[model samples]
Target: MNRLKLISALCLLGATSAQAAPSSSGPIGPNIGYGDASNANTIYDPLANPANNALNAADTEGYRVGLGINAQTRIEIQDLEGASDYYDNQIDPLLNDVANAAQLETNLETFIANYDQGNISTISGVTVPLLIKTDSMAGGLSLDYTRQVGAAGIIIKGTGNVTPAADGTNLTINRGSAALGVTYKQLDEFALGYGFKAVTSGNSALTIGVTARYLTLLSNQNNVDLKQFIDDNATGSANFSDYVDGMDTGSSDSNLTADIGINWMADNYMIGLTGMNLTEPTFKVNNMTSTQTKYDYFSSLVPSDYKMKAQYRVSAQVYSENREWTLAGSYDLAESNDLNNNDTQWWSVGASYATNSAWYIPDVRFGLRGNLIGTEKTYTNVGLTLGFLNLDVATTTTDFSGVEDKQKDAGIMASAGVEFDF
Candidate 1:
């Protein structure tokens, strides 16, 4: 079904509805709503090299508690590629498709082909479910404490983020002076998960672990059009259940899943596999759209029924005899509906050098990967460990060579944390 129409349909055919109070913000847009974000262990960033769990598994260390804090931002801007008019004049019009109505899809495609040419990385108004979040303005500070007990571990995290009131509202956009608008979505999450080494034997050559987890929700909400925003907050006057299939309406829904991992450790080498959301649990999200009709008052929840796909990944590593140098790689095993389709199955390779405190610096690392499988750009990463502090930075560029001007084309994400041994 055409997404906008289906999004329209979500409101029309609700078996039930979930209450999600809408929020209003500046008509001009805001840089991440100041209300809050997530305290993600760099592990969840999905973009860090040092935080690669696969690498962690390959080089096992004694039990320790990793208390960390990090913040980062990544922005993707189209290079324009010599075609400025196509985006500035006709892009939003193409995106503002009428519900259940025909679209300028062909025109949009032709323009993209002429410029983007299957380069889904540049950005588009008509995108798959995965890219929807990219446009949303997001900002947050994170605080997390992790404990590693032998092959078992646990994590406790608290995060506060400033996110736009609604999905698709970017901090900055090519929309030009187009009288853009903003809607804020409240994002507050708290999670506790434990990793259990279900089995490890034969001189610790093989091991498998399962992490049971839950993310608590508290009045998670978003603002849509002016009318629904008021109705959704009418004190029990609104519900979006019947019209939606997989929407997680209001505060009455499940927010839990699990991950399983297996690793093989041999002399100087290790390879492992892990799967998240193994239970196949699915949830609903309120669909945010531009044009609103009578049905828009109903659900507008996207993926009305979706079983969040389980993600599986494979990783391997080789270590130097002296244990001072190591190399590792990460690759996803499948395409997951839970994330951007283009970002699925991304792989990264990196190398780390532990100086054994010889130079007063414990470790230094480097990583390289094709961002979105080189569909968008290339990412180069660096990591440093000085004293009790660890720092990691990742930079994105269209070309690997440093010749490209950094000012005009690049996105960056960097993180730092302090560690203590148990």
Candidate 2:
């Protein structure tokens, strides 16, 4: 049993070697709406103008700054046999032995079943001026400028021990990130956006993206330590300390990446292809030898050194719209990468209805939108746009996996803001 536990721990740690970086943007639901511009908007429609970089003839004069906020929570639990193995190997062997192996198994099963029944993992944050959109129609050509700034973080609670322990305890990892983006659009259809950010203190990089009707491309530079920014801000916290220590300062490398997308509006369809980390760039961290010796050994055993290869993604959307109602469906191809095997490809379908009321308020439009991604997960968004103020709220299954044992891993995300055209 002890040997089994040790083996399990090693396996878990090995698995951690490829944990991919978290996504930098928010969820874009499946719906065709103007609010879909910023990735943060709950509308799922891929055809809708992305809030971050979209510009239209209506945005010709002055500037608009949209302050938006979103909060999301997710929880996962599984009746895992490997928990005991992990506990035995990574945690204290003597604290609690599997005196009654059968009983322990039963208990673990129950825990997994009820893990999300009562427990949840949450991520909450506020983004002010989530996007800045400006456009001008002059010289028979249109110019568009867009910018965004926001902060996000994740907090995980509850546990059946999914990852390796740092100090023989249930891993409690907290991660936070901040990002800023600027995009310029020309002739209402072509765009270029640049993004820079830091995730965990050790990971910092600059990304530049370009997009045209039916196509989008992106690229990035290599790991650049963010501690300098934190230190400059004089906001030193324990999280910052950990981030600084984890940074790989010795390696200075850059990555070349690209993505291409195509949209066919006449047929109510859209398709997109994206490639991430295409440059196969390699950036080495000095502490990797000591902090992650096992990873070093594992890497040596592989066919080649750690090279950042291109990750491919394909997505499509179909929509039908009328004066009072809209329906849409979308599919996103999942990339099979070493870092995230459990991550599966998924699709979403959604519907929405709009009505204008004259009884209570003047010029009031209310809409309800719902989306289902994959088999077991669903999200519904309710919104009201009165005059220049647009308010939206959404509820979604926090857990991406649609398994009953892990069903409790779900929650709601709500956002509200005003978009006024000047």
Q: Write the per-residue lDDT of candidate 2 for residues 1-422, one digit (tens) a residue.
A: 12222222222322222111112112322121222222212211212222213321222233444433222222222233233334444343422343433444444334334322221122222222234444341111112222211111111122233222122221211111111111111111122332211111222121123322211211111111111222222332223223323321333323333333322222243334444334433433232221232222212211212343444444443333222333444343333222111232334344444322222232222222222221133445555555444455555543445423323334344444443232
lDDT of 1 by residue, 96-139 (tens): 33331233434443443443212111111110000001111111
lDDT at 6, model 1: 16
TM-score per candidate, in order? Answer: 0.51, 0.40
By TM-score, the best candidate is 1
Off by over 4 Å in 2: 1-209, 212-256, 267-324, 334-344, 354-420
Question: What TM-score quantifies how close candidate 1 is to the native fold?
Answer: 0.51
Worst 10 residues of 1 by lDDT: 22-31
Model 1 lDDT on a 0 to 1 scale: 0.34
